[model samples]
Target: MRIARTVGMVMAGGMAMALAACASVVGSTESEVQIRTNPDNAHCDLSGYEGFAASVETPAAISIPNVAAPVTVTCRAPGFRPTSYTLNASADGWIWGNSALFLASGGGVAILGALVDESRAAGKSYAEEVHYQLSPDRPRPVRARSRDGGTDLNLQAR
Candidate 1:
């Protein structure tokens, strides 16, 4: 009876560790996000949790850390008004799955696993793509239909 109890404890511990390691093993703490703007070549600044800060040109892909904190992205262009957007974090699916598994298993070890997963960096994720539409500071150039059915830019300032 004593040996059976010890074996059971060991198995439970191992299972807990495996489950707890799911996020760290199969998930990532950082993900790549594509940043884009209506007019390309705009400069952008990203700032938020963990002192995360980076600058990139528009139409670029960058790897960013994942945290359950709001990230602000500010973009600027030569003739456009500066624009900023907030990137909100969402809880990772693994957290829910881990918790569900723990509840299904009906063990304290599973509870620990769920907690471990939630407390780690794999608990949250950011959007895969972010886009911004910048309005021009000056009046937009007017477009006129040309004789050949093509469009012509009427540079006359509005």
Candidate 2:
């Protein structure tokens, strides 16, 4: 009888451990990122995102993946010179995935997280609000000054 009870308890413990591994302590596969621009309404593109979530508009919010590489954000607005920025993903401590086995949620969640949410403190991905200020491009129809003390409009197109 004693032996049978011990075996049952051990089986229960094992089941609990397996469940813990499914949980992650940090960032998930799908994360939220906010995009903002100084003037607003700028076109934004996430160059490194693997799926359809590659692009959005300024003042936009979108979901991103934790396991994917850092993404380059490109922004462009009319009359403003296009600017490029980057969003980085670092490894999260929870990536160890072994902690989950101990019910710490920081362990053993690596592979599970990778398969499900990709949770890892340093390995996990998080989003930061990306903002940019676009500078105005030079306008055409520039004027020229001559040494003879005369100003001429070069609109004739040399």
Candidate 3:
């Protein structure tokens, strides 16, 4: 019984350590995420961007920390419709590796070990690239021919 218990403890420790390293963090804490807008040079503001510059013109790159929360951004350009979008910060898939540790770690220890691993590794990250599309303030007229032959339909802009 003593030998069995000793072996179990050692196995648990090894499993925990191995699982910790398996975590594949998609992006690093200081990874730079490029932010761009279709209109270029537009003003852009990002939320939850760690300590890096939260505000910058479109076509700019900024470093953001890895976090579980999604990042939000708003972009605006002259004579263009302001646009807002969210960046997905998904949890690392290697977290599943922790599940294998349950047999060795028993219960809470496995979960705690996994959490510790994630904290030490990349926690979360915005995508490598974020792009936003903004539409012009005024809708361009569409040229359409009337069903009555040669007549053109002219719809005035509101």
TM-score for each of the candidates: 0.75, 0.59, 0.63
lDDT of 1: 0.78
Per-residue alpha-carbon lDDT of model 3 for 29-146, expressed as tens digits? 4447898899999998777634333888979988766552466788999989888887766655555666666665576656765667566545445567877899888866777788
Give the C-alpha miss distance for residue 69 in model 2, angstroms: 2.2
Q: Which tens-of-lDDT digit does each residue in 1-158 have in candidate 1? A: 99999999899777767776466557777778899997899999999887989999989998888763578999999988998999876777766656665675775656676566556667677789988999888866666778898777586553
Give the lDDT of residue 91 in candidate 3.
Answer: 59
Each model's lDDT comes to 0.78, 0.63, 0.69
RMSD of each: 8.0, 6.6, 6.1
Error of 2 at 96 (Å): 5.8
Error (Å) of candidate 1 at residue 47 is: 0.4
Superposed Cα RMSD, model 2: 6.6
lDDT of candidate 1 at residue 69, scale 0 to 100: 54
Tens digit of per-residue lDDT, candidate 2, span 33-144 = 7878878999887766455347777799887765456777788888788888767876555555544444543445334544543433234655556677877766667567
Best by lDDT: 1
TM-score attained by model 3: 0.63
